[model samples]
Target: MAAPRAVIVHRTSELTELLARHGTRGQVSFFLEQRGQSLAAVEERHDRTRAALADVTAGLPVDWRRASVERGELARSVFEPDDVILVVGQDGLVANAAKYLGAQPVIGIDPLPGVNAGILVPHAPAEGGALAEAARTGAAPLCERTMVRVRTDDGQSLTALNEVMIGQPGHQSARYTLDVDGRSERQSSSGVIVGTGTGATGWCSSIARVQSPRLALPAPTDRGLAWFVREPWPSPSTGADLLAGLLHGDAVQLRVESDQLVAFGDGMEDDRLTLSWGQRVRIEVADRTLRTVRSVR
Candidate 1:
C-alpha cells in the first residue's frame, strides 16, 4: 500500500501580489502611500503567512508524501481517498477546498490566527504537523458538517458548505416558482438562498435576523437547512407568502420563469450552473458531508 499523502492548499499573500503588480518594493511603497497605508504592515502580514507555511511544511513527517496547490487550482487537483488536506488560510479557504474534497479529512489551519476570526480554521500552524499525522492515522476527531445540494433537471448539480444562491447573475429580480413541503408559490424577487446548518451564521443568519428573533436555525451538525427569499416583490401575478422556511427530508424545488437564472454554491461565482426559462431545480441535503478536524485539546 502507498503511504498516505498530504495536500497543503493556500493562496498567494497580498504582499506578493502587490510586488507582482508594481514590479518593485519602491512602487509598492508609493501605491500604499497614495492610500495612506503603511507598507511595513503589509510586509509583516506577508512574513507571518510565510512563517506559518514554513512551520507546517517543516513539521510534516518525513515518510509522508506531500504536495501543495493554490486555491484557484483546486478544481484541477486530484485526491485519493487516503490523502489528507491541510488548508492554510481563512475560513473561506476551507470552504473552497471542501467542495472539491470527497471523504478526505481536512485540517483547517489559520495562517494568521491572531488577525482572523478562524471560525472554520480551528487549528493554528503550530498544530498542523500533529493534525496531519492524526488525519493520516485516523485518530483525528472529526465533525461532520452538512452541505446544501442544488441540482437542475437537465442533470447539473453542485454542493455548498455555506449556502447556495439562486438568482439573476447581474443583481436583477429573478422570477421563479418555489415549492417546499407541498406548498408552492410564484415568486418575483431578487433570488433565493438555501443554506445548511453550517451556514446559519453567514447569509442565512442575516436573513433570519430580520424575520424574527425566535426563528431557530439548525446547528452545524444538524441535517436540516434554512432558506430565505430576498426582497420578494409581490405583484398581482405573484405572491410573497412563501418567502422563508426550512427544508429537510423533502427537497425545495424552484422553476425558473425568467430568461436566465444562475445557481452557485459557497460563493464560487466562477463555478455555477445556468438555467434558462422553463428549467427546474431542486435543493436538498447532500449525501456527502465535510469531515473537518476538530481540535483535540
Candidate 2:
C-alpha cells in the first residue's frame, strides 16, 4: 500500500505580495523606504519562511506523496481521508485550514518561531520532518479542538474553528430573535458571536471580559459553545436579558428580523452565508472536531 499523502498548506509572504503589487523587489524596497522603512526585516522574514518551507519539504518521508496549497485556495482544495495536513503559517492559518478538513491530523509549523505567539502552531520548522513522519506513522500526539457550526433553515451551513459572527455587513445593528433552552427573546444588537472552546482566548474572551463576568469559558477540548450578543439594546419591543450564555445541548436558534444578516466563520468574511429576513439560523457545536498534532517532546 502507498503511504498517505501530506498536504502542505501555506500563505503568501508580505514581501512577495509587496513585490507582486510593486512589480519588482527594488520597487518594493523603494516604496518601503519612502515610508521611513527598509525591506531588510521583510526580506528576512520572507527568507525565513522560504527556509522553513524547504526544511519541511525536505523532511517528508520518501514513500509519502506531497501536495501544496495556498491558504486562499483551501475552499476549492480536496483532501483524502488518509492525507496528513501540514500548515506552515501563523495560528490563523491553522483555523483557516481546519474548517475544510475532516478527520485528518494537522501539524501546525510556525515559520518564525520566536516572533509569533502561536497558540495553535506548536511545532517549529526544525520539527517539521519529525511531525510529518509521526503523522504518517500514526504516532503523533493529538489535541482535539472543539469547533462551532451554523446552519440556516435554507440548507446553508458553515463551520468555524475559532468563532462565528452573525451580523449585518457594515457594522449596522442586527435585529433577531434568539432562542435557547426553553426561552426566547427578541433582540436588537450590533451582532452575535458564537465561539468554541478553542476560541475562548479569542473573540469570546473579549466579549466575556465586558459582558458576562460570571460566564466561565470552556477549555479547548470542551464540547460547549459560548455566545454573546454585542451591544444588545433594550427597548419596549426588544429585550437585553438574553445577551450572553453558554450553549451545549440542542443548538441555539436565531430568527433574522433584519433586511439581511451574514454568517461567517473563523474570520473569513468573503466566505459567508446570507440570511434574509425571517430566515432561521441554528448555532451549535460542530459534529466534527479539529485534530491538531502536538509535540511529543
Candidate 3:
C-alpha cells in the first residue's frame, strides 16, 4: 500500500521543519496561501522560505509548489480535491477558502504579528472532541457539506452557506408566493430566508425565529427546516422586544405592499426576486452538504 500523501501548508518559518519531518520519506506537497499578500511580498518571502525548506529536507524527494493565484482565482483553485492542503491565514481566510474547497483537511498557521511563523494545523476543530481523537490516530475529519448553486426565476442563481433569500425584490416592500411540500401558503412580508444548517447562525436563525421559534434549540438536519411569519421587525415597542419576537419564529415573511424591497445575505443585497403583498415566498434548507476540515484539538 502507498503512504498517504500529506500537504504542508505554512508560511516560510515552519516550512523547513515541516518538510524535514514529512518530506523525508513519503510523497509530500506544499501549498503556501499568499493570504492576499502583494506579489513582491510573496516573492521575497517565498524566496527565503523556500531556501530554508531546501536546506532542511536536503536530499529528500519532495514536490514543492507555491499556490500563486490572483484573488479572483481563489474560488476555482482552492475548491478542488487534492492530497491535502495546509493553509496559513486567519479565520476569515480559512472560512472563505473552506467555503469553496469542499472542506478538505485544512491546517491553519496564524502569522505572528509582523513576524511569520508557519506552523500548520487544522482550521476549526470539530464541535466536540472528535477531531482530537482523529488527529491522535492521524485521521482527517471532514465537514458536512460543500458549496452549491441554486436556481431561481429568470435564470438566476445564488451561492449560499445557509440559504437563498427572496424578499421585497427591488426598492418596493417584497411580496411573494410560497409553497411547502407542494402546498401553497399565502405570505406577506419583508422577504423569505432559505438556508442550511451552517447558515443557522445568520439569517436562517432570524427567519426561523419568527416562523417557528422552536427550531432554534434543536439540531439542524439535511432535510432542511424552515418556518413562516407575517411581520417584519420595527413595529415593536422596543428593539429588544422586536429581537425577542424575531428569534422565536421558524421563518418570517415581511409584508411590503408598497414598493419593492431587497433581500440580503450576511447583510449584503444578494439578488432581486419578485415579491408582493399576499404573495407566499418559500424558505427551506438546501439539500447539499458543505464539507469542511476541522482540527482534532
Task: List the RMSD of every prediction in angstroms.
Answer: 1.4, 1.5, 12.2
- Rank candidates by lDDT, best first: 2, 1, 3
Superposed by TM-score, candidate 2 places the C-alpha of residue 31 at a distance from the truth, in angstroms, of 3.1
Give per-residue CA lDDT, model 2, range 1-297, as digits (tens): 776798999999999899889999889989999999889999999999999999998888778899999989999999999998999998989999888999999999999988876888878877887887787788988999999999999898899999999999998999999998788999999999989888897778888999998999988899998888899999999999987888777678899999999999988989899999999999999999999997665
Model 3, span 1-297: residue lDDT tens: 333333333333344444556573122233333244243444445565454333322321244333433223444454334434444443233334443444345544333324432212233211212332343245756555422234433343345554455554443333443444433333445545555555555555666666667765223334444433335443332111122122212333333344454443333343334443443332333344444455345
Candidate 3 — which residues are off by over 4 angstroms? 1-62, 68-79, 83-138, 146-149, 153-155, 168-172, 181-183, 206-212, 216-221, 227-287
lDDT tens digits, residues 89-140, model 1? 8888888888898999989888886788777888989899989998878898
Runs in model 2 lying further than 4 Å from the true structure = 34-36
In TM-score terms, candidate 3 sits at 0.47
- C-alpha lDDT of all candidate models, in order: 0.89, 0.90, 0.40
Task: Determine which window of 10 residues in candidate 1 has minimal summed lDDT.
Answer: 211-220
Best by lDDT: 2
Query: Which residue segments of model 1 deviate by more than 4 Å?
Result: none
Give the TM-scores of the predictions, in the order they appear: 0.96, 0.95, 0.47
In candidate 3, where is summed lDDT lowest over 10 consecutive residues? 238-247
lDDT of 3 at 90: 33
Listed per model in order, the count of residue pairs whose N, CA or C atoms clash below 3 Å is 0, 0, 51
Better candidate by TM-score, 1 or 2: 1
